[model samples]
Target: MNDTVKRKLNIALRINWFCYVGLLLLFVVRNLLLEGGSIQLWVIQTVPLLLVLPGLIKQRYRSYLWLCFILLLYITTSVVGVMMPTRGWEDGVMVALSLILFFSAMMSSRWHRMQ
Candidate 1:
């Protein structure tokens, strides 16, 4: 296989393991540790939705773009976290940040193949 194809495959494999596997574990942790079966859990679940959004789009996503997206979300979450004390909205934001972090780490490839 060409280097480009091989690189893409490797990255995709890594993404599957890291994001899916790690996120699943975190979901369990949130349920076990935090307010289980409550709104908190619900918020945590929505996090994955944002993480997977880039995949649904037609354009090929590079690691830099992914990182930028995650960082933007992270920054938004952090700001919201500090400003909003209420557990209702902010907790969801926190979950979102966690999701971004995990997803970014997972999807990131050593060599990004942009199309």
Candidate 2:
């Protein structure tokens, strides 16, 4: 890859990581505050994401691809949360973060393949 592509790839990867971690933290805190610290909820929400962590850390293109697929579940739920009568700001944040994560992961995977 050229320098520009390399730089863009790095930026995309960083954004991917940021959104990934942010979503994870959001779920954890939301569970703690709203769900009374439900362990089952945390595991259900986080384990799939955690499963792809090693691939993400290794900059594997397939991992980014898988992350995008996993993010769809979150996106769907967050959208539903946003539409609910009792929604909070966190629900909006979750939608935004998951969307960003999805696009950035797609970009990262594409760039990684090019490299």
Alpha carbon lDDT of each predicted model: 0.52, 0.93
Number of the top-ranking candidate, with lDDT as the measure: 2
- Model 2 CA lDDT for position 50: 97
Encode model 1's per-residue lDDT on 1-115: one tens digit a residue. Answer: 4777667656665554454445445555656656645556546654744565566243344543564455455456646755665546445645565555545544543333422
Count of backbone collisions within predicted model 2: 0
TM-score of 1: 0.39
TM-score of each: 0.39, 0.95
| lDDT score at residue 38, model 1, on the 0-100 scale | 58
lDDT of 1 at 40: 67
Candidates' RMSD to native: 6.8, 1.1
